[model samples]
Target: MGGVNTVNGMTGIIMLVLWALAFGATAFALIHALRQRSDAFTAVDKLTKPIWSGILAVALLLLLLSFGGLGLLAFISIIATGIYLADVRPKVDEVQRGPRW
Candidate 1:
């Protein structure tokens, strides 16, 4: 429990939950980013597909770093995911398909 040293049972559980969430979010961002057409990002004036892909990859790596006592960085990854999901996603979706309900 060197890098991953946490308090005890309850705290460890909470950290596990947080790490799961971070991984999930990063995975979502990476998947969606990969599925989009490259032109969609240009049309939407967002990060190019490769750039977003790299960002999501780093997010995944950062989440993994929780084992190295860098769990706090998970929040930064979440923020990146939030921006991709909340801002870029809708624009890319709209470019590729019509607005939906």
Candidate 2:
């Protein structure tokens, strides 16, 4: 029999999936930030490459420690990662690639 502390069934599966996704997202953001050119961030008027990388690194660490729980710090990390991926990434890429026109 499963103990009180044990997670089982559908809920457990969902938690596992969520944890994986959160961890993946943070890790991906960190890696992407690290790979980008240092000047790209300044060109796009975003934070410096080192700052972004640091933020993502911290976020990844928080996500790993959170274990899928949406605690305040973990939630903030998720938001930070999301911002870097959704907003900053495209601008940085565009700067690196130059204008299409």
Candidate 3:
């Protein structure tokens, strides 16, 4: 029982870390999207808006799931992240030259 409890505690800690990371990523994406919404980054605004929305949705879902709720939210987030990484981001990068690249 003690071992089981220890494992559970570790799992909870891992989940909390994942939750924090997801929250941070979503927040960053949202902020970047908003900042890019202005005239300066209008070229990529189309891409960033959807990406930001997706991230926010995913983060919210993950948050809800971390509390014993259904993991549908996390699943949605995974799909969104995959789409953003595989499709949206590449196209956006092709059109613009950001400092990070």
- What is the alpha-carbon lDDT for the whole of candidate 2? 0.86
Better of 1 and 3 by lDDT: 1
Model 1: C-alpha RMSD to truth? 4.6
- The residue-by-residue lDDT of candidate 3 on 25-47, one tens digit each, is 55555454444433333465554
Cα lDDT of model 1 by residue, 1-101, tens digit: 85456457667787677678768878988999999999999998887999999998898788777652335687888888889989999899998996678
Task: Report per-prediction Cα RMSD to one decimal.
Answer: 4.6, 2.9, 4.6
- The Cα local distance difference test for each model comes to 0.83, 0.86, 0.56
Error of 3 at 40 (Å): 8.4
The lDDT, on a scale of 0 to 1, for candidate 1 is 0.83
What tens digits encode model 2's per-residue C-alpha lDDT throughout 1-101? 67643645657678768778878988988888899999999988999999999999888888778775667778889899889989999999898888998
Candidate 3 has its poorest 10 consecutive residues by lDDT at 33-42
User: TM-score for each prediction?
Assistant: 0.80, 0.85, 0.58
Best by TM-score: 2
**Candidate 2: where is the Cα deviation over 4 Å?**
1-8
